[model samples]
Target chain A: MNHKELIADIAGKIDLTKTEVEHLLDIIVDVCCEQLEGRGSIGMQSFGVFDVKKREERLTVHPTTQKRMMIPPKLTVNFKQSSILKDKLKNVPS
Target chain B: MNHKELIADIAGKIDLTKTEVEHLLDIIVDVCCEQLEGRGSIGMQSFGVFDVKKREERLTVHPTTQKRMMIPPKLTVNFKQSSILKDKLKNVPS
Candidate 1:
């Protein structure tokens, strides 16, 4: 499901209109980006934690030309599934 | 930030009341969970993708006891950040 579908599905289940759900989703993404950029993390019960991790600069060689490229350090968004969520997923029948 | 804090923050930025934001967040989490449970994936631009991955059962040796453990096959929730989010995080100065 894409963003629109998610919003639509969620809106159907909740008491909010499509527009409200859309705005809520937009705000959520915006807030998460801002918080992560500010070095803050988000934690939700039974879901997961969204964190910003610092990655060091690294050198990579081009696969085709054998040329080296230097990648700069950057912050990365990392999500760790909660044990509850993990358990819930793991128990699903194949 | 925790769930409450997230709801509070997002509510402050949007026109929705705190209660509405809280409900919206709850629905978002619920819908995502249900979709993942059903082996569906959710993707959002400039954010990330939430997917369900099947993990095969594996044998692992205990670190200190020299015992082998059998990990059962299970589903896992995987999140892949979008390229736009990645670059935004990468450009942050150390």
Candidate 2:
């Protein structure tokens, strides 16, 4: 489902107004982004752990030209599913 | 960070009471689990998508005895981070 649909579902399930749910969702997204941008990680149980990983600069060969190229250091976000969530999903029917 | 610490952080950031944050977190976890168990996915923008994936049963060799064994079908939860979040993380300093 998309964002609107997901928010609707959350509101229905929680008996909250759509506006309130949307506001809260926005806050959650903002908080997560801010945390990762500052500390490189946000740990939440049952949901998952979001972390930033860095790849150092490296020399790589160009496949076609056979020339060496320097790849710049980069950062990436990684998500590790929580074991509790994993176990729950494992039993879910397809 | 652990669950409690994470909740505390969320509460502090949002200016919500710890108890309220904990309660909402619990509800979120319950809703996600219930949705996955009924269907197979929960899609949330800005956060990520949580979906159940099935691994079909297969025959595998036992390394020690070299005997064929049947591997049962398995389900797993997969998370695909959103591009927006990925970009934010990529710019984060390590």
Candidate 3:
């Protein structure tokens, strides 16, 4: 669902107004971005863990040129879903 | 960080009490789990999209036995990060 619909769902579940839920969701996104940019992690129970991982510099071939190029080290965010959530998804009917 | 600390972070940014934030978080987790179990998707802007994918049933050899076995169809959840969030992560200092 889109942001507005999702916020409405959250508002219904949490007994909060749509505006309040949207504000909270925005805060969540903002904080998560800030934390990951700072190389930190955020764990939400029954959801997943969001963390940053740093990859080492390496050499890789340029796909089009087929020539070796230096790939610089960089950080990336990874998500590991909770086992409970994973199981629930696995059993979902198609 | 763990669940409690993450909730605190969210509460700090949203100006909500810890209890209220915790309740809201719980609702989010519950709804997400329910949605995925129903083979639905939830997209949280700046965070990521959570959705279920169904894999076709197939025949595969057992890892140790090397005997052919039929693998049943199953569902899985996938997350795709937003490009803006991905770039923020890629530029994080190591």
Candidate 4:
């Protein structure tokens, strides 16, 4: 489902209008992004954890040119599914 | 940040109260989990994609006993970040 559809679904589940739900979602995304940019992590008890992972600088050979280069260390967002969601997805009984 | 703190952050940015924000966040999580359980995927334009991936059953050996075993096929929640979020995370000027 796309953003609108997802928001509509959530709106259906709760007593909120679609627009209000959309705005809230946007705010959630913005807050999460800002937190990640500030080098923080967010954890949802039932969903998962979203955090920034730092990659180490490493030497790598170019696949085509065969030239070795040093790739700078960088940050990327990572997520680990929570056990609740995992069990739900796998349909395994806890 | 924990769920409460994150919701508080979002609440500060938007008009919603902290409690309302928490409720919305919960609704979001519930909807997403239901979607995944229903074998569906959710895409947020500015954030990322959440989808369920199916793992095929495979044969593997236990390292300790060296006994062969079959791993059952299962479902997992996977996420792929959007370019917008990735660029923000990498600080790429685009």
Model number with the top DockQ: 1
> What are the per-residue Cα lDDT tens digits for candidate 4 across B1-94?
9988887788889877888778778878988888888888899979999888788889999999999999988887788889898888887321
Q: Candidate 3 chain B, which ten residues in sequence have the lowest lDDT sum?
A: B84-93
lDDT of 3 by residue, A1-94 (tens): 7677788888887667998888888887898888888888888888888888777899999999999999888776777788878777665556
**How many residue pairs in model 1 have overlapping backbones?**
0
Best by TM-score: 1
Q: If ranked by lDDT, best first, what sequence of candidates would result? A: 1, 4, 3, 2
TM-score for all models, in order of appearance: 0.89, 0.74, 0.80, 0.84
Model 1 C-alpha lDDT per residue in residues B36-73, reported as the tens digit of each score: 88889999878999998888999999999999999988
Among incorrect, acceptable, medium and high, the docking class of model 4 is medium
10 residues in a row with least lDDT, candidate 2 chain A: A85-94
Native contact fraction of candidate 3? 0.75
When 1 and 4 are scored with DockQ, the better candidate is 1
RMSD of each: 1.9, 3.5, 2.9, 3.4
At residue A72, give the lDDT of candidate 3.
Answer: 89
**All models, DockQ values?**
0.71, 0.48, 0.63, 0.53
lDDT of 1 at B8: 88
Error of 2 at A7 (Å): 1.8
Model 1 chain A poorest 10 in a row by lDDT: A85-94
Error of 1 at B69 (Å): 2.3
